[model samples]
Target: MGFREYRGSRQHTHAHFVLTGHTSFEDEPPLLEELGINFDHITQKTMTVLNPTKETDASILGDGDLAGPLVFCLMFGSCLLLGGKVHFGYIYGIGGIGCVSLWCLLNMMSLTGVSVWTVASILGYCLLPMVFLSGASIILSLQGVLGQILATLSVGWCSLSASKLFVSALAMHDQQLLVAYPCALLYGVFALLTIF
Candidate 1:
């Protein structure tokens, strides 16, 4: 269907006709006849529209609050299990915490029944940059440039993740937020396995 404006005393709008699936203007004789509109000798125009309020089932998959802290614990535990000695283990554990925390935050934001596009946009512009920075920090650390830089970056990612979690919590209602907590915890456990 398409919208058309009627030039009356007051502005009026209405849908003209429905377009059958994959049917071009040339094939829409019935639609043309019903609307008393001509399909021939008319230019076609394409327009894009975005609905910010549309939510999808995919948004319900994860939660952040429970996942964040659980992930923090698992990462720390894995570092110890790997026999990372002294400060080395602690550093690796902290890095894991940051990555997991961000993942949790993303999950939590999704549970609020918000628009999928908005959630995707936020993840792309915000969460992705942090992940990239943390990955780069890990690479630099492996290269033996400066250990402190890696630590700084890892902690920075965690801090940003935590901040996003808080924002998502405030934006969503209490009951909905509570429901997503379990999934977040599961995410944390799974994340730990992946890292180890």
Candidate 2:
């Protein structure tokens, strides 16, 4: 048998015992007696211990990988509410769907232990084509060369900002509060461009 003692404040004192062979609680008496320790006044009480094998379980969401999606959902949901009243149909529809999809992917990946960089790269691949398409559409919708250039730039900024948000969300699972921060800033700039 091996013994270790832990000292702390008066409220708690801990002792750890390591046994080399099988022994029962009843066998402790002789060992205690030999060690000049007494346990006559000690009382037995019920105690419960919780052990978790999976790191992604619901109980560990905030401390685990699930924090990424949880934060993304909240940020996107708030954006929807704010933009909804303004009748920004594109923001409410396509943007909302994209954010929700990203959130779902994050949740699934949390259980799978997929790397955040992989998630970000996949999202980039999916969004890159759309970025090109949106830019082309904005250019074609404009009347003059200058107008086409400005519109393309504006749409490109919006798309790039959205892509950055997805990347940020995937990379920083623990810091979800800023998941949509980049998107929101870009959205504000896009709104200003639309007004001008």
Instruction: Residues 77-139, candidate 2: write the lDDT tens digits.
Output: 344344332324543354445445555655564434434433332333223223333344343
Local error of candidate 1 at residue 71 (angstroms): 5.0
Predicted structure 2: lDDT: 0.37
Q: For residues 1-196, could you state the per-residue lDDT of candidate 1 as single tens digits?
A: 8889887795323433333343346655585456533322111100000111223222222321222223334444444344332333544454456445545555565454433333322322222223333344333433343544444443344334323433443354343334334323433332333233
Q: 139 in model 1: Cα distance from truth in Å? A: 11
**Model 1, CA-based lDDT:** 0.36
Task: Give the runs in model 1 whose Cα sits over 4 Å from its true position.
Answer: 1-72, 85-145, 172-196
Each candidate's root-mean-square deviation in Å? 19.1, 21.5
TM-score of each: 0.26, 0.25
- Could you tell me the C-alpha RMSD of candidate 2 in Å? 21.5
